[model samples]
Target: MVYTISAPPHKKQRITFSSINRAKILTLLPVSLISIYFFGLPALGILLAGILAAVATEYGIQMIFKQDVTIKDGHAAMIGLMLALLTPPEAPLWLPVVGSFIAISIGKHAFGGIGSYIFNPVLVAWVFIRSAWSDPMTPLSIPHIGQFSDLLLEPGAGLLVGVSPIALLAGLYLIYKRYVEWRVPLLFFLTVFFFNQIIAFVSEIVTLVQEGVLNPLLYLATMFTFLELTEELSFAMVGVVIFGIIFLATDSPTTPVTKQGRLIYGVVCGLLVSIYGLFGNYVDGTLYGIFLANGVASFVEARTIPASFSQESVLERSYNRVMEKIPSALKFEVISDD
Candidate 1:
C-alpha cells in the first residue's frame, strides 16, 4: 500500500496598500531630508508644495473621471516632488505646482493614468518648466554648508541641481530587489560617459593654450554624474547607475517590455543626450532626450512587433519595421543578445 500527502497550492503574496505607501514615503524621505540639509528650507518647501499639488491634482482628476485615486501608488506625487527638487531654488513656487498639475493631469492621466504615459512625468514637467522659464532655471548660487565663503574654496561649487544620491540609492535598491533590469542605467551612463570624454578631450585640446578656460564637459559631467544621476547627496556612483537603470529606463509603461527593445531604447536615449549636450545650448537636454525616447519607444512598440514573437525576434522585427516605416531614417538593430 502506498500513501501520499498532498501539499496546498501556492498563493500569490498580496502587497497591502499600507505597505506600498509606507515604502514610497520611506523612499522619498531620504532625498527630501538631504535636499533640506544642503539646499536649505526653500528646496524643502518647494518639494512639499509640489507633493501637495500633485496629490490634490490627482485626487481632483480621479473625482472628475470617476476613477479610483491611486495616491497610494506614490509615483505621481513622488515624481512631482522630484521635479520640484530638481528645479532651481529661485524658481517661482507656482511653477512647480503648475508642473505637478501638468505632470499628473496631462502627462500621466491624459494618456490613461499611471502606466499609460509615454514619457517620464518628472521629465515632462522639467522640460515644460525649463522651456517656459529658461533664465530662472539656471543655477544662480552654489548650495553650501551655511556659508558663502565656501564657494571661494570649492572649485566645483554650484547649486546642486537634480536628485539626491541617498534617495536614489534607496529607491533603486527597492526596485532592483523587485527584479528590474539594470542594463538601461548601465547603457545610458556608459554612453553619456563615453561621449562626455570625447567632448572633454576635444575641448581640452582646443583650450590647451588659453588661460582661465573652464572645461565645460568636465563641469557638465560632474553635474550629470552627481546630482542628475541620483536622488540624494552622496558620492556613490552606484546609486546613480542604479537610478538610471531602474527609475529612468524601467518605466514599464513607456519602456519596451522585451530586453532587446529596452537596450535599444536606452541606447537611443544616451545618444540623444550626448547630441543634445554637444550641440544644443540647453543644459537640461538629458531630460528632454529621455522624454523623446520614451515617445519613440511607445510608437515603436505599438506598431512594430507581434505579441507572440520571442524577445530577440521582436527586436529584429522592430528594426525591420522601423526601417520600413521610415526608409530615409537611419537603421539601428541588435546583432546578438550578448
Candidate 2:
C-alpha cells in the first residue's frame, strides 16, 4: 500500500471588525452618556451636527476624488462628534459643523483618511474651532444635572470642565489592554504635571514676597497633587492624551513602525503639550501639541524604513518564501527505529 499526504486547500482570511475596534467604539459611549446626562439635549445636538458634517464631507470628498466611499468606517464621524462634545456649550452651532468639516476634509481625508491622519482628527478640529472663535470657545457656565447656582458661580459651568475620573479609568484600562499605547498618555501627563509644578513653585515664591508668607499657590499645589492633577485637568487635555495613545501616535500610516521612532514621537508630543500649556492662548493645549507632534512624527516615519524594503524584487522574493512555507508545515511523518 502507498501512503500519500496532502496539504489543506488555501483559504483567504476574511477581514472582520476586531474586538479591540469594537471596544474602542464602546469606549466612546461612556463619554457620550456622561455628556448627555450632564448637559442634556444641546450636547446631543452638537454631537449629531458634528457627526453629520463629518460624514457628509467625507462622502463629498470621496465622490469628487473618485475614491471609494468608506464613511461606514465610522471613525471620522465619531471623532468629530467627540470633539464637538468637548467644546464649550455656548459655542456657535456653525462652529461645530465647520470644525467637523475641517477635521474630516483637511485634517483627515486630505492626508488619506482613517488611519492615515498623523494628528488626532478631533484635536485638529478643536484647535481650529478654538482659534476661530476664541471667546465662545474659551468656556461657558451652563446648567448640569444637579447644579443650578454652581453653574452661575463657577467659571466654566455647564460645560464639563474637569477630567472625568470614570473616563480616565476607562482610558487607562484600554491602555493596559494594549488597545492604546501606554507611553504617550503616561509621558504627557507626567510632563504636564512637572511643568505645572514648576510654574506653581515660582508663583508661590512671588506670593511669598508680596504677602511675606506662602499664599494660595501652596494650597493649590496640594489640591492639585491630591485631586486636580487627576480631575481638574480638562477632558480636552485627557482626550488629547487618549487620542495620542490610541489614534494619532499609533496610526500605522503616519507613525513610525520601529520602537525607537515611537519613543521619540511620544516624547516630542509630551514636550509640545507642555510648551502649549505654558505659552499657547488656548486652555486646551493638547490639540496644538498633537498637531505639532504629528508633523514631527510624519517626518520621522519617512526616514525610518530602509531603501532595500522599497524594492519590488526584494519584496516579491520575501512574499514567495512566506507563501512556500505554508504547505510543508501541514505534513505529518512518522519514523520507526529497530
Candidate 3:
C-alpha cells in the first residue's frame, strides 16, 4: 500500500495571488475607463498597447526559460494597466509597448519574477521612458469643466491617474477590502502634510524677520492661512501621494513586514517625497520616493523583527553583564537547589 502525498501549505491562506490581482484589476478598470473617456483614443491605445506588450513579453520569457506560464494570473496585465495610467496622454503608442517590455522583461523577470521585484515595475518603466524621451512624455493640457461637473470629473493635467478623483475612491476600496494596510497611507499623508506645514512656517518666519515684525501670533495666523490656500490650489498633489501610497509603495514583497518596520518605511517614503517634491522640484517625486524606500525595506525589517528564541542566549549574556556591573549588595543572585 502507498500513501499519496501533497506539497506543503496544508493550511489555507485568506489572501492569494489571484485574489490580490483581481482586486487591483477591479479597481483599476474603472479608472482606466474614465481616463479613456476623458483622454480619447490616445489613452485607449496606450492601455491596449501596454497590456498586450506586457502579456506577450511575459509569455515569451516563460516559454524560453521553460518556466510554468503564469500570464493568465493577471499580474502582468495589472502592471501594464498601471504603467499606462502613469503615462502621459500624448505619449506615442510605441511608448507603452517599450515600457511594458521593460517592466515585464527586466523589472519583473530579471529579479525572479512576480514577488521578487524591488521597485514597482510600472514606475520602473515610467522612469526609463521619462528619461529617454522627455519631450514626448511632457504633460498634456487638461480641460477644466467648472461647476458641479468638477466634483464628478476634474481633469487637471499630467498623468492620467494624477487628474482623476476616481483613483482616490478606488484606493479607498482597496483599503476596505484589506488588500492594503491603512497605516502606510496614513503615515505617508501625515508626513507629507507635516513637512509642508513646516516649510510654510519657516518661509513665513523668514519673511517676518526680514520685515522687522514683532508679533509672532500674526505670523502664525498668516502661515496657517497660506497653507490652507495652498492646499486648495494644489489639489493635484492628492494623486501623487494617494496613488503611490495605496498601490506602489504598499507592494507586500517589496515593503516591510512587521508593523513597526512598516511604520518606519512609511515615514521614510514620506520624507523622501518631501525632499523630492518640495526641495528637488521633481514632478514624479512620489514615484521616485517610493522606489527608493523599497531599497531600504529589507534593512527596516531586519532591524525591527523581534529576536527569536535562538538569539535569547545573546540577550541573556548581555543581561548578565549588566547585572555583574551592579554591586553585590544591589544584585539579586538566583539561589540554586543543591
Candidate 4:
C-alpha cells in the first residue's frame, strides 16, 4: 500500500469561516432567546423571516452567478439573526424579508461576499430600511415604564422595554473573550459613560442657571447628585448600546485590527452615539454611528497600526538604538561562535 502523504506533521488549520460563524451563532443565541422572551412570538416570526430571506438570497445569488453555494457556513443565517435582533419587534413581515435580501445582495455580494464586505450586513440593512421607512423602525410610541416616575424619562425605555439584564452580561462576556480585539467594546462603553456623565452634568448646570440658583461653591456636589450615576444607568443597562458594541461594531472583517485603531474607532462611534441620542431626534443612534465608523475604519487603521520592522535584520536597528543609549555597553565587542 502506497500512501501519498507530504510531511510528518500534516495538519490543517482549526479556524475557518464555518467555525467563526458557529461561535458567533452560539454567542448570540442567548441574546436572541432573551429577546424572544421579552417580545414573545412576534420576535420569533421576524427572526424566522430574516433567516429564510437571507439564506434564499444567498442561494439565489449563487445560482445567478453560477458559482459554488456559500450558505453552508451559516454566515447568511448569522446576518439574518443579527438583523432580527436589530429590527423592531412589530416590524412588518416584508420588512425583514426585504432587508435580508438587500443585506445579502448589496451589503455582502456587492462587495464580493462575506469577508470582503466593508461593513456589517445587518447594519447596512438598518441604514437602508431606516432611510426608506422611518416610522416602522423607530421606537414604540408607548412608554414602557410610565408608572415608575424615576425610570420613565430614560431615553432607551421605549426601545429596550423589558430587556433582560443577562443579555447585557452575556454580550460583555462574548466580546471580552472573542477572537477579535476587546478594546472596541471596552472603549465604546467607557466612552459612552464618559459622555453620558458630561451631558447629564451640563444639563443640570443649565437647569440650575435657568432657575437662578447656579451655585459655584456647590457645583461639584450638584454634579455628583444630578449627573449620570443614576440617570442613564437604566438606559445603558438595557440592550442596545451593549449589544451594538459587542456584536455590531466588533465585526472582525469590518472593524480595525490594531489596538490603537480599534480604540479610536470605538471612541468615535461612542461619541457619535452620544451626540445623536442627546441632540438628534433618534433615541438610539448606534446604527448610524457604527455605519459612519465603518465608512472611515480604513483611515483609522492606516494611522494606528504598530510600527513593524522588515524580515531582513529585524532586531538589528533596535539593538543599535539601545546600544546608542549606553556608552559603556558599546565598548564591549560580542562575537558569535556560529
Best by lDDT: 3
Mind sharing the TM-score for model 1?
A: 0.67
What does candidate 3's lDDT look like per residue over 223-324, in tens digits?
Answer: 566546455334224555567878888888788888888898889988998788775533477888888888899998877787776675444767888988
Worst 10 residues of 1 by lDDT: 231-240
Q: Residue 38 of candidate 1: its Cα lDDT? A: 68
For candidate 4, what is the TM-score? 0.78
Model 1 agreement with the true structure over 18-85: per-residue lDDT tens digits: 45445645765765676567667777778877889998999998888898877877766667766775
For model 1, what is the C-alpha lDDT against the true structure? 0.62
Model 4, stretches more than 4 Å misplaced? 1-14, 141-162, 210-214, 222-228, 281-283, 308-338
List all candidate RMSDs to the true structure. Answer: 9.6, 13.0, 5.0, 7.3
Pairs that clash in candidate 1: 163-231, 164-231, 164-232, 165-232, 165-233, 185-245
Q: What is the lDDT of residue 138 in candidate 3?
A: 67
RMSD of 2: 13.0
Q: What's each prediction's TM-score?
A: 0.67, 0.65, 0.83, 0.78
Q: How does model 3 score by TM-score?
A: 0.83
Report lDDT (CA) for all predictions: 0.62, 0.61, 0.78, 0.73
lDDT of 2 by residue, 255-327 (tens): 5665556766776776777677667523355557767777777676554444465565534767778877878
Q: Which lDDT tens digits does candidate 4 get at residues 192-260?
A: 778877777677778878878859338758447533465565444445665677778888778887778
